[model samples]
Target: MQLRFTTDNADAAVLDVEVKELVIAGWVGRDRAAVLHHIRELEALGVPAPGAVPLFYRVATNQLSQQIRLEVVGEETSGEAEPFVFFHRGEYWVSLISDHTDRHLETFSVALSKQACIKPVAGHAWRLSEVKAHWDRLELRAWIKTNGDWITYQQGALSALLTPMDLLNRYFTDRQVEEGFAMSCGTLSAIGGIRPSSEFGMALHDPLLNRTLEHTYITGSLPVIA
Candidate 1:
């Protein structure tokens, strides 16, 4: 048996993300306004709006199209820090797991320092090129049967390689994503200190990957590293 995979666009892979939690620092008298202002801006941009608490955003991505989308999903307030929680895109279906552990969800929170950290339950980061390569190796083909006419896309394949964080109009479920809004306060809370705890963020979703973290967060995905 031979399987065929497509490699039409290795440079246009997007990663989908669900917002479990977002941790941010600098909680003061003025932060309330800043948070509200930020929420308003996000809502204006089409992100799902949150209530009067911390903020959260949902994300999704497409590899071939190279687009990502983010929407606000959940919110909560820690005594010290605010945690914005969100749901995953593929949250409804059972996730494809490597270890058969049945881990279906991944969570991320922005620390008070302003760095985003992903929880361990999150899946691995997928690369467009890598997925394309896997598909191509499979040699899979799709056939369309028409009356006296036939059309086929030579180098196109959809892969289940990338894991999804947030899905839309699908199912509903919830999970704990953050340790706390503010693990630590004071000068120790710098934006630099806020980092994604999951490998998906640190290694795959690096800040310099495309100069569009905000875009990725909203859209749920980005292109492969070309």
Candidate 2:
């Protein structure tokens, strides 16, 4: 699927560029305890804690998804509401993505668990510059469909996570986001313990800009045939 971006020339058509690389920025938070809370939450599932602040793992461009399917039964998964940023044409564009993850595998391998699920993301995006100034005003949210009802799974201010600039500086050179590099910058905590859901909805709302980037997808679990 092609990732779309807004151009500097409002009159010009939007750019639809294929991503070259996919970067997953983990443990991205302003506070160490907050980061650890995420790590410990996973640790409760037996995933070892990382001894560091900004952890990153690379995923193939093909793992990027608009919808996702998983074949592993007993594989609990959850949608982590996060800001998706991709660099193109020497600029950064923003979108929202549900960092669909394998909770069962997390205890065995965090990276493998991350790579195990297709990353569901929105096709539309806004220019990073357009929302940088009032960045804190942006809110991130996710809802899980439980028992035929949509229940809020995650919700919080973007301010709770690390600023995009802070993340870029820690993971990239010169604090300049390179073209074709995409990162699903961290997520907010869950309302209840993480669990699987048939449907996951995510959004990035810029109240200051009075706009939002949203995406929703159905997660179909394929039979785990051994």
- Write model 1 residue lDDT over 37-108, tens digit each, in one string: 755664554444443342223221111111122211122111111111222332221111100001111112
Off by over 4 Å in 2: 5-9, 68-75, 174-177
For model 2, where is the 10-residue window of minimal lDDT?
66-75
For residues 1-226, what per-residue lDDT tens digits would candidate 2 score against the true structure? 4666554456535877788888888888778876777777777769878756788888878878764443334448767889998887788888888788888787888788888888888867888888888887899989888889999988889888888877878887656565678888988878877788878888888888687888888877766677
Best by TM-score: 2
Alpha-carbon RMSD, each predicted model: 20.1, 2.4
C-alpha lDDT of residue 97 in model 2: 82
Candidate 1 ranges beyond 4 A from true positions: 1-30, 55-226
lDDT of candidates 1 onward, in order: 0.22, 0.79
Cα-based RMSD of candidate 1: 20.1
